[model samples]
Target: MEFIALDILPFSVVDDVCFRRLVEHRYTLPSRSYFSDVSLPELHSIVETYIHELLAMGVTAISFTTDIWTSDVSPISMRSLTAQWVNEDFVLRKAVLHAQECAGSHTAAAISMAFEKMFETRKNPKNKVHAVLRDNAHNTTKALEECGVASLPCMAHTSGNR
Candidate 1:
């Protein structure tokens, strides 16, 4: 209960009157230090395990989508990648895989390295990822060529061009 509470809700919520009353003061609340040291690591471990399970599931091939953007609040540019695949149960599953800071400028070489690191989470990501869907930036196309993955332009963006 403490783990779930701390994992999902803000730290200040631990002191909420309603939350305190609901517990009836039976269980001793875990301190914030515990959450930082214990619960957070556990959460990361569980998520990594789940991702491996997904990779093990029977699927023809996986597709990916990625884009780069810089938030107004942050000086660094970041790339976001999402995975899409049909699961063993014949259900389509989609997950946002990563949002990581770009290593350097958004050149083809740099983007290719970023893509490799993101896919490394699944190990042999190049073989599993059939293609990467991205906006029609010259760098994206060049990166896909260098990485040996097919480049698919976002249909929405292509259609807009038409």
Candidate 2:
């Protein structure tokens, strides 16, 4: 499961004969259905728990970065939110809080609502979010503003380096 998820390999890779032969000596690979159905959900739950625990500990302030983009080949639009903070040990930690498909238009309201949902679901307090760094798109800026979140423009976007 870790091999598939970490390497971003297709589920079908588990069924490849050569791949199976390579690892069968020490491990048994489950079916693709098992990965899609069982392993993935379990992995998600474990990671979610870890993130919640980390945030509930000594973390006081979190900086966020969010963006939305549409695929050119497909009509799918995705919005992602990432959180970064220094841990109690003074080590920097970063995690992607959300990366989900957007259903409709990328309006300010939609973006803000999505962010709120992610924070709420993760059990992270809004007050803990120090600031958001994002592209200077009107909708994105307005979205964070609507959520009462402080935002800074991404220098890459501002300088046209993105």
Candidate 3:
């Protein structure tokens, strides 16, 4: 429920807790006292393991998008949209890579390169890239075009602004 509130609602973590408190006085927040801190190397190893497992399962091809943000200390942050080809029918599955550094055009180019690497790792060199759906960012569009990937403007954005 905490994750759901964080992902789908505009409320902050504290706001979510407060909301739950308002609904039920007897309920208590989950305890964070028993968690183990994972080392950076361990985290990387786990991610690599998952990637290899995905590749072994015949996942290939991908599409990407990026969002840029500024932190309180003026550092740039990025959120990434990544997708993989699933099954023989070509339905795409996606995951988010959050709070990465915003590198502008380079970030967009990196996403394309990541897809290329995923294709190579899956041994599917003939993978078809259908489209990159993103907000109308010039650098991102340029990068996608340069990578020989077609792009489509985000329809949700166009609709929201209409």
Candidate 4:
């Protein structure tokens, strides 16, 4: 529980410390020490393992949302694509998704190649492709088309004709 609290709970380092202390006192058990032993990189890998499992279970689809933005006040844009999917259990309806670093300057061929490479790296190739989802940009649409995959524009994104 402490491990989960530290990693996933909505709290800061201070909150974590307070929560851990409170729990320790209430339950008379040692607070979680695992955080001290695990590195951030290791935690990322562990989380990625869970992500892969979710992907393979049809919990996420190939259709992605993308945007460009800058971290600083001055605009230096970056583009990325994310895969999304849903997991429907008895009481919970959760969505799983992830984004990958990508270049805005890349051509259709390049984007397609990059995505293809990404798919190859995934443990389940079949789950990585959602035949119906489409790319918003014309270049990405063409790239998706080259794969012999049907691509449709996101209807929600279409300009409203007033």
Off by over 4 Å in 4: 1-38, 57-79, 86-98, 124-128, 132-135, 160-162
Expressed as tens digits, the lDDT of each residue in 1-162 for candidate 1 is 344654677765557788778875779877766766887678777876787688677866999888988779988987898888989888888877787777578889988877777777656457777888999889988988888888799999899987
- Tell me each candidate's TM-score: 0.81, 0.93, 0.51, 0.55
Candidate 3 global TM-score: 0.51
Q: Report clash pairs, candidate 1.
A: none
Candidate achieving the largest TM-score = 2
Candidate structures ordered by lDDT, highest first:
2, 1, 4, 3
Per-residue CA lDDT of model 2 for 1-63, tens digit only, reads: 898889999999988889978885778778999999999999999998998899878899999
Candidate 2: segments with Cα more than 4 A from true spot = 25-28
- Tens-digit lDDT track for model 3 on 1-162? 334323654424424656666666676644222111233345555665765565446555555454445579865656454545565456555554333555554465765665455445544343445566777666667766766767788888678877
Supply the global lDDT for candidate 2: 0.90
Q: After superposition, how far is residue 158 of candidate 4 from its true place, in Å?
A: 1.6
Maximum-lDDT candidate:
2
Candidate 4 per-residue lDDT over residues 72-134, each given as its tens digit: 775454545455555544222222333555655657887677656655664536444565354
